[model samples]
Target: MYVAVKGGERAIDNAHAWLAEERRGDKAVPELSVPQIREQMALAVNRVMAEGSLYDPDLAALAIKQARGDLIEAIFLIRAYRTTLPRFGGSNPIETETMTCDRRVSATFKDAPGGQVLGPTFDYTHRLLDFKLAADGDVDDAPLGTPHPDATPHIMSFLDQEDLIQSEPQGAETPADLTRTPLELPASRALRLQSLTRGDEGFILGMAYSTQRGYARNHAFVAELRIGAVAVEMDIPELGFAIEIGEITVTESETVNQFQGSKTQPPQFTRGYGLVFGMTERKAISMALVDRALRWKELGEDNVGAPAQDEEFVLYHSDNIQATGFLEHIKLPHYVDFQSELELIRKLRREAQENIMQEAAE
Candidate 1:
């Protein structure tokens, strides 16, 4: 049992005051407004929103500001705030196929349908610091391109038509919400996808990287990586129809893994899918690789004892908020626990010394 210590209320209040003052930084400089953070530090906002499992950009920006740019802290704040929100209902499943593509690229095929549009990417740019941006953050307007008249088709469809890729049949059953319920083992693909989508980007990336480093390696080829705004619709009970509520930017990646053939099944290319909020290409791609690695059992492949293949390990430890909470709790007062440990160690030493003294006397 842990003992409750008192008398730190004044100290705690003073520390919070100091934190607020520190967050403000200087009186001379202008304060960073929520809008500026939402707009300028959009990627950070997106990450917080993704991990927090909340779609409010303003709240994420505010959380970032309140946390003094500490993303994990911002996520924690957003998550805590999220619990109080009332849920009206769930939205219709987003149709990524109809996304207005801002950026689309494929590593597997050259000149795939919906020609590669390198929209707002630093992939080709030299990794040099722009000294001009430091002094003055002004730039000329970027040239615009004509929007595609037709809905950009998914590249996987080409393989699907040929029956070259493993078919993923949609299930009618409603997927369990990880946020609402406790995670159970032997989780469905939908649950895994949900966990991975909101999982820590760094952790997901590391797991994906592990797969590439030959840990249960399934050679994955990026069939398509698309980033765009997708319309969100909600079914209205009164109207008896679904209406467009809003739009959200998302990054989707579909990776084609090496063909897996068994005596029963034909040699067919496998798939790894990832869909995430905002233009988080790296995270999306990483999620795809990890998602594919996790599908070894379903795909009729050997486990190979990979970390990514361990569903329990990946799902349980993926949430940064949970991980940080357990880790950070150690820093708090462990007086009772520590005292017990200290007393035990001292007792052991005394017993050993007494035994030594008895032996010497003998």
Candidate 2:
């Protein structure tokens, strides 16, 4: 049986009008400018860009404003907008080693090649929210000391040179794009990273937390976490040389985890890598932990059936857009289904009562 509810057009239009007013809030206050959101709410914009797979701050800011500060909604808007744009050739991979880092830290080594520069961080900040920020959004910039002229070498490279850490073979094959193709189980490292990089922050954080609490424990140490601006370049066929496209701020984290070397391999440390748009260290760190946990099979470790270890589970549930659509779709009218369920329950109860009455009479 099927039932169709009619006459929702006017109601939907009225609801949308109300939603528009709600989004604008009180008219007395000036509407938030896209520039204001971009410059002030930079972190939110960054998250939108990162998840949306687009890195335009202005567009991200506009999306944020349109979404009424709902980050997931903003990301959805950006992703939807991105899908309509014409494709250009891919840019070259960023050289993070040459990045002009604003912040660099190493947990493993006390004094690394570049030295421990806590350029700008909330790591040691008091959690107390300053009410003053509500009145004034201005923040004073701190002075930066002279940075090391030499490139900040990776800590893992040093370990790798000494044969203390497992060396990964460089792959010449181009990685698969998750957006272009359907997700397959037992994804490659590149595919897994693509999923993690765009996955919901809270979901990734929770999965990473599970690993710390002894579920597929990886004993990860932050080998190095760097925040900086890297140059983006693209090759122009006409020019026959790569040209600088633009620069983007990024956070990169490398985690060294405990290893269980097998008969063919010697005892060596393994690594998990995370790279995300903007200065999002927390997300990057969390991403790294989850990435490392997912590589149990490749590392010759037993599968403990942990949430982090399940590629299918992590990859499937990590997408917020997909999750949100299914969750919100439940609100749609299911009158026919409900009616069927109601009749079934009523018939079952009636049969039970009749049986009881007959038994009592006997």
RMSD of every prediction: 1.3, 2.0
Q: How well is each residue in 1-362 modelled by candidate 2, as lDDT tens digits?
A: 34566888888999999989998999999989999999988889889998898889999999999888999999999999998999878888888998788889999999787777787678899999978778766666667665445578887888988999988888698788887788888789999999999999999999999999998977999999998888899999999999998999999999999886976667889998899998788889999999999988878788888999989999899999999998987788888888889999999999999999999999
**Candidate 1 lDDT, 295-324, residue by residue in tens:** 887777888999999999998899999999
Which candidate comes out best when scored by lDDT?
1
Clashing pairs in 1: none
TM-score of 1: 0.97
Consecutive 10-residue window with the lowest summed lDDT within model 1:
141-150
Model 1 residue runs over 4 Å out of place are 145-149
Global CA lDDT of candidate 2, please? Answer: 0.89
